[model samples]
Target: MEEQTIFHIINNMDKVTNNLIVQWNKVFEEDLGVSHILVLGHLKVHGKSRPSDIAKILGLTPPTLTYLSEKLVQKNLAKRLVDDSDRRIIHLGITDKGIEVVQRANQKGVELRKRLFEQLTKEERKQLLTIYEKLNKSL
Candidate 1:
């Protein structure tokens, strides 16, 4: 039998991972985009942060993240504000509405993850998780 290459495994995993993310996006009916949800979720987890910090954490550039932040602001989901001490610093924080969206989105995301992984046995889940962690660290 022929041995499958490492790239083959990575490609296959990327396909499934991306597809699952796409499907989860379909679960949202609100004005919240995936970036908005993720950004809000990060804010909720880490408290307030500068826009540049958020960009760094998410691996997004300033322009791209600025656009997302603007969209969230336009939708009343997030706010970009000046830093209290450093007026030049632009910070981001989720509004009550943003928190609500993150909560709902989190629920939906959890549901989809459960739907995808619940079918696998404990050992299979552990193996997939171990491999996924390794891949993430390798990247």
Candidate 2:
């Protein structure tokens, strides 16, 4: 609860996240950016989804999602679907290639995390998981 403690926690969290991203990028071997991979992952999990919904869920602006989706569509990793009942409604769906990309990215991510967490003892890992879950639930 002290100011210094909060600052240290936040600083360490940022460093951990940056390190993970940097390491992931090195092993990912994909030309896509994190935002693009996140969009693909979302579509893989959620099936077809409205751009607005994806934007809200991902904490991105509608225009930013639009730009990201445009790149995805161009790469054939995703497609636009027009609602049958309402032509005004549009959804984004991931393709087979997108699924493959997501799977590869996930594997690399898991491997990277495992290597990073291997530094901790089993009990420390459990404590970290519990603490992270508690912090996430607060959000």
Candidate 3:
């Protein structure tokens, strides 16, 4: 609880996150970014969903979701479907290719985490996880 200690913790977290992003980008290799992967992952988990729902779940703006969806559709990773009963209702669904891509991305993510945390001992890793869980609960 000192102010300086809190600032140091915040700064370290930011640095760690930025480094993880860099590593993620290296492993991902595709043209898609993290948001695209998230959308695809959401669709894979939730099946077809409306753009508004996806936006809400992902904490993205409606316009941002629309843009990401457009890119995914263009890349054939996802498709937009109109509800049979309602012309105004549109749903976004992941394609077969999208599933494959998301699987590969997840595998790469696992590899990245393993590489990054390999230096930490099992006890240290457990402690870190516990600390993170505590911090998350507080948040």
Q: By lDDT, who's the top model here?
A: 2
Tens-digit lDDT track of model 3 for 42-84: 9999999999999999999999999999999998999999999
Name model 3 segments beyond 4 Å from true: 136-139
Q: At residue 73, what lDDT does model 1 achieve? A: 86
lDDT of 1 by residue, 37-60 (tens): 778888889987888889899888
**Model 3 weakest 10-residue run by lDDT:** 20-29
The reply for model 2, stretches above 4 Å from the true place, is none
lDDT by residue (tens digit), candidate 2, 3-82: 99999999999999999999999989877778999999999999999999999999999999999999999989999999
Deviation of model 2 at 11, angstroms: 0.5
Which scores better on TM-score, 1 or 3?
Answer: 3
User: For every model shown, what is its TM-score relative to the native structure?
Assistant: 0.82, 0.91, 0.93
RMSD of 1: 2.7
Backbone clash pairs for candidate 3 read none
Would you list the C-alpha lDDT of every candidate in the order shown? 0.85, 0.95, 0.94
